[model samples]
Target: MAVSQSSVFSESARGDAALSQINITPLIDVMLVLLIIFMVISPVVGLNLDARLPQANREATAPTVPPLQLVAQADGRYRLDGVVHGLDTLRSALVQSAANDPERVLMVSASADADYQAFANALATAEASGIRQIAHGQ
Candidate 1:
């Protein structure tokens, strides 16, 4: 009779081969637990304090003086208080008005067909004449 030897290790059990796939089961479990905790605690953590905000006065005071109207025409002229004036005359008039009342507001309106240069010139003249407050009108 002859005695035979058998090996217990298999060829697939070799340690030289590295793991190619990653296991995400633990990561998914942790993420689900965190999501559940947040959902359960979010309502308890919210603030429900009652706040009293200060109310503003709704009454509006009327202006002491009416605003001066300046309209820019398409023909490169300006209408100040319904009187047409050239650029030089407009500058002089604006300067006079500004001297009279420095707080007076000038409301500028441009005609639909008015040149952009005319509008810009009107603004520039108003600023040069020491007018502080200027407003735009439709």
Candidate 2:
């Protein structure tokens, strides 16, 4: 009887080749089971509470005093509430208005062809007259 060592070694090497490669069937099954468990429990984990938000009042309150409108014209004159006023007159009026309510807003507007100097003078006058809130308009 002749014993071949090469044949025995070859059979063992083939068995090791199969063992070296990883089998992923059990890993895939475990992942799918975890995914299903998370999907079923996700909805129940959220809080379900009834909340009551405060509603706004439907009543409309009117303003006590109307806003002052000032317009700078191209002729170097200012218009206060549609009345044209000279530089000195505009200053006096602004001072009187500020005396009434210093917190009131003065809306200053200029025409497309209005003088830039006039607009600047109007803003300066308002500031000098103690009018704190000044708004620009088209």
Candidate 2 residue-wise lDDT, 5-107, digit = tens: 9999999999999999999999999999999999999998886878988887767654657679999999888999888899999999999999998878899
Error of 2 at 41 (Å): 9.6
Error of 1 at 56 (Å): 9.0
Candidate 2 deviant stretches above 4 angstroms: 1-45, 48-64
Kindly state the number of residue pairs that clash in model 1.
0
lDDT of 1 by residue, 108-137 (tens): 989999989999999999999999999997
Best model per TM-score:
2
TM-score of each: 0.56, 0.58
| Candidate 1: regions farther than 4 A off | 1-63
User: How well does candidate 1 match the true structure, expressed as C-alpha RMSD?
Assistant: 7.2
Question: Cα RMSDs of all predictions?
Answer: 7.2, 6.9
Best by lDDT: 1
Candidate 1 similarity to native, TM-score: 0.56
